[model samples]
Target: MGTEPDIILETRQLSKTFLGFTAVDSVDLKIQRGHIHALIGPNGAGKTTCFNLLTKFLEPSQGQIFFDGREITRDKPAEIARKGIIRSFQISAVFPQLTVLDNVRIALQRATGLSFHFWRSEASLRHLDGRAMELLAEVDLADFASQMTVNLPYGRKRALEIATTLAMEPSLMLLDEPTQGMGHEDVDRVTRLIKQVSAGRTILMVEHNMKVVSSIADRITVLARGAVLAEGDYAAVSNNPAVMEAYMGTTQGELEGIHA
Candidate 1:
């Protein structure tokens, strides 16, 4: 028997076009298992388009996507999700009115194929609480398990989203702009939380915060004008002249200051 591949997910010549304009131009990506890979680019650089193609939210105009050594370019979004690629925050995964623990419980229920059974007794669902709390603890939201999810702070809401995503038991977690808007403390908390939860899982994140990327990413792929411009560890990518010029323009000094 063959050994499992080191690449958990990969894209070959992935391209997408709209109305004769290309959004993602022949982008190829290889995401190694058990590593946090960051996809970063300046605004309008096709990062979101690339993510949509990978998740099957938008069909690729050309190229192929593979997960776990299987071609999945033709799979639907739900199909890819079931294949262990879960995109968090692309859609809100938590219910505002539900308690934090209940939010996770719902996700667990979905994963177990019991999501449609609303008629199931509350007592039967209580069994999911322990596991739900564990997921909450993984994102450092254990103490807020009983609180209404809507009442939690913004940063904590993001954490709850992570917990709910975890309940789906994803092997590859796609986090879109995990720290898009936040204060220093919240960013630090979520950054640490992401690193902590990445113990056995592979994470592919599109993050704008250089500090967050430098701190936790095992590899970085820099995009420019809808194509790959550079790929390396934080240090190598940050120091690349092409990346510095394309991503930060003339402000290369600011780009060099970002360090893990």
Candidate 2:
């Protein structure tokens, strides 16, 4: 018999509600190891809620979360993060006043599990600077290492955020709209950076840009209202008339309708 696929992350009957409102309802998701999975949907489709549940930001009202074969549904956010699951929000989550090197240095220190040495000279902290520089180079931000994070372009800032997150050495990274407000050029740069960063790590992203979704997603899941509308390869989703009509709109709907 063929061996069962090892699931890196799994959620069964995942759901969330606020008072009497249902944001996400009975959503089941599975993600394999070392793949880039993209979640696409219109606004108010519970994409953010899903992200929150996965990262333990909000406890699921009626579901279970498993990571690497262990249950994580009830775990605290920090506990989950320490177990190699890190998340980045839609907004830029960085120290705007700090230099690029300083930003990355702080991340490295956290990843090294050294949070108590907050007052020590980072330069003299046992290869912290060297490690920080290496991560910067990995994310193509070495050239801007000494520059203030706020001074860099939007695209560069996004890249730096990824570099900082990488310092945590996450096994799976959940990104919520990493390119939400970026212009065309910056969007393209973030896409390329995501591909480069996914070399050995698994990534789950909620993206609205169809172009970015088509370019880098190894698998796609379309969400609508509050559940999985469709899940398949690029062509399958791109050709599904219902998916196109519901999520991608009339343009994609027309194209995919014919193809379907």
Candidate 3:
């Protein structure tokens, strides 16, 4: 007997529309537990729209969303987040004035949903310091805990964002373009960090960088014209003519680079 496929996230007929225009059609996607799933498409492929729908940043026009076998199509963003679905924001999310450790501490505070008005004291926040630093060290920011967030380099700043998100201790992480606008070294660094973090968590990401997706994705879903074009492993999707044709010419030579 074979073990069944463990799906952590499933969407049935999920869709979104803007007036007369359909941004995301009736699409179904499944992400297994402990897998790195990548959603890729051209600029107009509705990839980001699907992500917004999943994250509750934009509600779907019609569909059912199930996270860990629980229906969350009607749940609010905060409610869904509390259920262990957390999305990592872009690099600008960190507190510029606060130190790295302090930034993570605030995230942990927010995750706990503490009644800030009830108990207000630096002493109350003391116990969170060690846990915050542990999260920073998980992302390799242990040495820079005392540095102001704005003083960090662009890549480390992004790492701080990841650390802050980690403070939530999410079971499922949704990352949108985690390595966007990064140079070669930063991209490599963040890629490694992502792999490290995905050890026990399920990751669903909307990414344009084919190289990063190819390197880390356990399964790839290709979207085109607001719908899924292909779904499979990297080897399968990378070789699919439909997927290649979708990115041909419009993706600025990304397909050719993937071939190389």
TM-score of each: 0.95, 0.91, 0.92
On residues 9-128, what C-alpha lDDT tens digit does candidate 1 reach at each position? 988899999999999999989999999999998888899999999999999999988888889999999898898999996434678998988888888888899987878888999999
**Cα-lDDT of candidate 1:** 0.88
Model 3: residues >4 Å from true position, as ranges? 1-5, 90-92, 115-119, 249-260
lDDT of 3 by residue, 1-260 (tens): 22235998998888999997988998999999999999988888898899888879899999989987878999988788888888887212788988998888888887677723435587888799999989999999999999998899989998999898888888889998888889989998999999998999899988777888888999998888888899998888877888878876434345735521
Error of 1 at 154 (Å): 0.4
Error of 1 at 87 (Å): 0.3
Q: For each candidate, what is the lDDT? A: 0.88, 0.83, 0.85
Better of 1 and 3 by TM-score: 1
Q: Count clashes in each candidate, considering only residues at least 3 apart in sequence or on different chains.
A: 0, 0, 0
Angstrom error of the Cα, residue 81, model 2: value is 0.2
By summed lDDT, the worst window of 10 consecutive residues in model 1 runs over: 251-260
Better of 1 and 3 by lDDT: 1
Model 3 gets an lDDT of: 0.85
